[model samples]
Target: MTEIWNILFNPLPNAIMTLLTGMSLVYWLFTMLLGDGFEMGTDADIQFEGADVQDVDMDADTQADLETEQHVEPSFFSKAMDFIYVGKAPMMVLVTLFKFISWIVTIASSLVLNLAAFGWKSVLILIPVFILSFFLLHYVAIPFVKLYKNVGYAGEEAHEFIGRLGKMRSTIQGEQLGAIEVVINLDVIRLNVKSKDGSLLSYGDDVIVTNQDPNKKFYIVQKDINLNNI
Candidate 1:
């Protein structure tokens, strides 16, 4: 046990990789509990400031940089990132996979080579390890990339939910959010919703979608009106 711990932390390469791997583990734990709340979006968001950008305090250099950024072509580094399928999967997914692979390779090589004596010189080994990790990530991310492309990103069509009729999947009252199960064409759409009128509605109540919040975070709903009463 002492030998393993000593080898892992005493060496610079293993220690750096271990720290990255531990951080990745914490990231995955949070993701599992809160979904991909931290994912950097599947698409690139590179945008140059346009006419709409407020220019009240914008300096000449900042404007020049933005203009230059607009026409700048993709560099080899960006293309290489795409080639490795990094942008297709969740950024952290690729990062975690790469860090884990690097950690394992470093530890295994350390065990066989007694690399602990190398000290800071061992950090040089990370270059090759990084290359190998990305190679592995490319293959691992292929299927997932294909799947996300086909499924499309979530909430792409939330606008369709307005005026839809659905049944409460859980009790809701006042401003409390709850799940409502609706069918859009053939697919079941369950979403978090709040009562439009602060009315008490139970799990089995039928409801109609009224409107959406400005931010589109959740839908506003009210109890479905029965025509028989009128």
Candidate 2:
């Protein structure tokens, strides 16, 4: 038994042992901070009613009633993932935080291992380990995190009116600091608009534009009172 323990734990090749210890410590710290092997999938909760498998000749009314109750519930995980990649969470913050924590653990482990073994030469082995960990964490882990966010757990119907025109729900002004809700392709989209005439437009206004310019990142809207009068 003692021989087995010695063989398993013995630092026969001191350099390899130091590298293994550092790597193990890094894995422990990463899992403890981030999560258990980074979740990379999304799932959605859906509910269905009137699923009568036994009744082959079901009434049309009952079948229609069942269809009415069937609905899909969007998953929170998909939204969170979208926010990470498509939204505004900066990549620098994600990379820097993980790197900082990993480095702290690596450095501390190297010190502890050297102290226990009473060897000055073991310190040299840590340089390669640190470099490898840094590269893996930055290039590999960071990209995986972004990919998980982009792919999402479940699929989402693409917003069809992202590039179409929409009627402004409220007055859009040059300096106004609020969003406008527009109905496009039967979907409501909230967008920011800027005024080209340096004037404030009223609610139920029509905003027409061929393209969005840097000067007016929102919209340069014009009033369509004829449509509103109806």
Give the Å shift of residue 44 in candidate 1: 21
Candidate 1 per-residue lDDT over residues 1-230, each given as its tens digit: 99778767868888999888999898779876887554423332221111011111123664464345333344576457667654234455566777888899888777777776776787888888888877887887787666644433222122366787987655667766665666543333445577898888776678998887665456788889788423
RMSD of each: 17.6, 19.0
For each candidate in turn, the TM-score is 0.47, 0.27
Q: Number of clashing pairs, model 1? A: 0
Deviation in angstroms for 9 in model 1?
Answer: 2.1
lDDT of 2 by residue, 1-230 (tens): 98544433333333345345556557657865876443321222221011111111224664354335323232464344333332212233344444554444445565456433745654465466555655455444556444533443111222322344555434445555223344433323344545556576555456553334344334344444455555
Task: State how far residue 46 of model 2 sits from its true place (Å).
Answer: 27
Q: Please, what's the RMSD in Å of model 2?
A: 19.0
Q: Lowest-lDDT window of 10 residues in candidate 1?
A: 47-56
Q: What's model 2's lDDT at 20?
A: 54
